[model samples]
Target: MTYKGDVTVGGPADVHELTDLMISKVAVGPMDNNAYLLRCRATGEQLLIDAANDAATLLTLIGDDGIGAVLTTHRHGDHWQALAEVVAATGARTYAGREDAEGIPVATDAALDDGDTVRVGQVELTARHLVGHTPGSIALVYDDPHGHPHVFTGDCLFPGGVGNTFDDATAFARLIDDVETKIFGALPDETWVYPGHGKDTTLGAERPHLAEWRARGW
Candidate 1:
């Protein structure tokens, strides 16, 4: 059960230490939703992002390690259905956008807007509202000890595409703008982009495609 390198689940544990961040991905269910367990090597503090669809598997991944916080990108069941169980098991505070907070079991602890920081041991994640897939979808950004900025882009921005738009077309369009002009455009080119459901890409890699995305009116 111990993952060693860059894991893609249902496969061997491809573990690797990225500076102070020990990363592992647990793909739960048929959707292949990736739930990330990020442990800060400096303090051994754990942060769980996107609980996916299987609570039992998530509990096993978390184990006895201290989970300081659990963050959900949106209200989609595949992304956060196991949140309540994780919270109960670890007592880890949950964070989500205020608009979708009601969907979560614990709503009081939910975050309301962009720029709110949630601390998990030594790691402090700044929440950025990247609404599109949902009215309250968000992304988390933080700097690793090596000073490499990492963004856990929930479902907003993927490797080469964007999240599905079922909410409001106008709002979804605006959300894409915010991601381009704010999230992706605002971060340093070297920032590592870990998305909710795809291969990892960087801010620099996604920058060039912004114009093409805009041309398609997405």
Candidate 2:
């Protein structure tokens, strides 16, 4: 099936196949958190992003091919509810933004900073640290070898607007600034956005409403 990028808890995952990598996106937990399982076609090396919930489901998705790393996009509890369970089961190394790493209960094997490279077999993902949604909210950027850029934006950039800053103007400002500079400014319009929750969107779909999102003060 074609990759629609829409998924529901308990529903089947959507798989997007690229030239050298495959992304399997599943929605899990009550919060409907999205977990992405990426596999490199060349070597079968796998990286699981956000073991949000349902270790059984995630582990089933893993099957016999064990995972190498589990990258939590942020420090949010909902996003890592199954982190310990999954890590314990697979012994996969844990990764998180450096500042948010201390907040997670599990020990981070890697404390990533902005522009860090995360590898899954032959594929490489660039970590773009966008602040304010949390002290450390990193979005992984995969410059697809065959197509446009694909970004795994945690809770930072969503379909309609940016992530919640809890009404703190300072935090909101920081988040918006980082998003604008690192995401909207740096990436192209066709960039595919895989957010932490809800459905997917593209940069072009949300670019014209930047000022509106700012004025609404979300």
Candidate 3:
């Protein structure tokens, strides 16, 4: 289950065996949003992130393993297009950032704030509230003792730059600062970053260019 260095991003729908966790990702809907199924090997308990779109496809991916919970990274419509359908079908508990919880049509069983933990079997993911993308947009941190940590940055931090701030300077600043302090500064360079869309990147690859991203004002 141990992996060396960084993980290589796969195509549209694929599963990556990362340490003790198995991550299955599928790009769905019109936006090409990524829906990830994270399964803990020890207890076989699982959690689904985004549930972005394509209910039929998401159900097929869920199969019989049964998702213990579904975590919505933010309240963005594109990110939760299939949320109701998926939750209805799976009967899984719903969790989201407290501030943005009202934006979603579905009721969240639990409101996850920064420092709150979501348990998937034995794995405990720490919630990091990264503002700007959405007031309560959060990234779940899985810090493995033996390997680099894995952070699911939902539309807040991306490969080359921070998520779009919709031309708001203050929001952009907040996102970059949070990423630098909460993500980059806290985790090692080998930490794997899985964003809301597109390919993944390691901290090491994006670390040196933080200044560049800041200077360019993206």
Clashing pairs in 2: none
The local distance difference test score of each candidate is: 0.76, 0.95, 0.86
Query: The CA-based lDDT of model 2 is what?
Result: 0.95
Ranking by lDDT: 2, 3, 1
117-158 in candidate 2: lDDT tens per residue?
Answer: 999999999999999999999999999978999999999999
Q: lDDT tens string, model 3, 26-59? A: 7786887888888988999999999888888888
Candidate whose lDDT is highest: 2
Off by over 4 Å in 3: 1-12
The TM-score, computed over Cα atoms with residue i paired to residue i, of candidate 1 is 0.87
Q: What is the per-residue lDDT of model 1 for residues 48-165, given as tens digits with 9 covering 90 to 100?
A: 8888767888877777876888888888777877877788888987878887787766553766588888776666778888767788888888876677688888888887767777
